[model samples]
Target: MQSPAHGRRLDAVTGPFTPRTPRVVAARRLHRRRDRDTAGRFLAEGPQAVREALDRTDTVVELFGTPTALDRHADLAARAARADLPVSEITDEALAALTETVAPQGLVAVCRHLDVPLRTALARGPRLVAVLAGIRDPGNAGTVLRTADAAGAGVVVFAGDTVDPYNGKCVRASAGSLFHVDVVRAADPGAAVAGLRAAGLTILATTGYGDSDLDDLVDHGRLAAPTAWLFGAEAHGLPEELTAVADARVRVPLHGRAESLNLAAAAAVCLYASARALR
Candidate 1:
């Protein structure tokens, strides 16, 4: 088992792990979100997430873990070593303070945020895409991203007012799929829909009261065209502007009187259905 007393010199490396101090703490918190957008940097924690980041080392800026984490995640540490990443040993207390969760997984990483241009995302040749509009829950946002990836979506776009994709909870909920998918934040919902249409992608918005039943509107044989699936926040369906721009408005047929599906579940159902339809 590795311990903080390992031969690695704590002061010799670059990235955020060089030395543990008040300054590093303050910098991490302040730059967590702002730097995410401007510098294209984000944070990842836990053994699994850190391992994933190490596999894609070009994306990692720094790696930190406690003695136990190093011992428990030897393979990850080996990868980090091969990547020449700055790896540092910190006290459990220090790791806990840097993380947002009550039980810190003893490992965390600073990574370059993925900047997938809207144009590039649209060009991915997706037969289906999922566009989330104003969904505020971080868990829902993450789950939707995971579902999109599972359904082989071309991309996942976040319209105005959606939760931050890098939020700790959202990142964890994504179970590392966040690293595999193209997720973009749009300036506005209307503009996003317009861009999709301009790319020759069909826009289909999901609504409980929609006139067209989803099953009837989607034809497996005719799914060759690029398509974007628009999902609304839980409290309200897609905004009026989005609904108005959609080429088609469709609904999932419900047998029970359940008011509506949770945003994440609905997204999964919609994405899976689209995948099946296209197959």
Candidate 2:
């Protein structure tokens, strides 16, 4: 008989599933980058991310959880019912074993990769987009994506050899914002920049040694235009060649003793600056 709660028939989850169960084992495989890439699927754990996944079309491949988790997140199950998505109740042990987090939060969602092409995102004529060039930190990259979404940027572009945006840690750090924004993975940084320029967006390269101060740009109304902010890896910042291609080298004016802002912080400051100016 189908369970009225989830509107799907599930096995009587007698106890925790063995770690060797086929479904559990398949989910465990996603812990590896290669497996995720090969499957074209990644895991989104916890209620928040899972909820966001359920809300998006064709994103959630499967939903798994323990009975307690499903009950705790009944709203999500209800939403899934409305969307005609199937939900399964796994054992707590199986849930924990399938995810990297110490606490599995009772639910996990397998979702399709959301990466789009750089040219496609650029073709949208975004008022603001973040171009992350070689940002290697998953936490920082995810935070930037969240910040860009909060700041109303039309999209985010991960250019060059940046960390995979679909990395588990990155997905967790995004805190549901991953579903709220269009994200592009650009294999070619140079070509990505060219596309942005062709779209008529002012490319502002952020660097510690930039020529124009961020405040000056805002005060001068320089940021009151369609723009894409170029941010680089924390260790090296933007390369000289990349900066040379930008319309301006912009820096955040820091008066404190703090040496530098972290990548995520810098991106937030830059993106919000543009958001404020353009308003």
Residue 2 of model 2, lDDT score: 53
Clashing pairs in 1: 40-113
lDDT of 1 by residue, 1-279 (tens): 223333222543432242356534743672356656665677788988887766663787777777678768767766676676667776666676667788878888878776487888877776788898988888888888889999998688888998778877888888887887878888688888888888888888889888778777655343446679999888888898888878778888887998888888778877887787777
Per-residue lDDT, model 2, residue 208, is 92
**lDDT at residue 58 of model 2 (Cα atoms):** 90
Q: In candidate 1, how many Å is residue 81 off?
A: 2.3
For all candidates, the clash counts are: 1, 0
Model 2: per-residue Cα lDDT over 1-279, one tens digit each: 458855543766534455776777897788888999899888999999998988789998777888888888888877776666767777767887778788778888888998787767766778998988998898888889899999999888888888888888889888888898889988888888888888889999999989999999988999999999999988999988799999999988889999899888888999999999888
lDDT, candidates in the order shown: 0.76, 0.85
Candidate 2 residue spans exceeding 4 A from truth:
12-17
Error of 1 at 170 (Å): 1.1
Task: Provide C-alpha RMSD values for all models, in order.
Answer: 3.5, 1.8
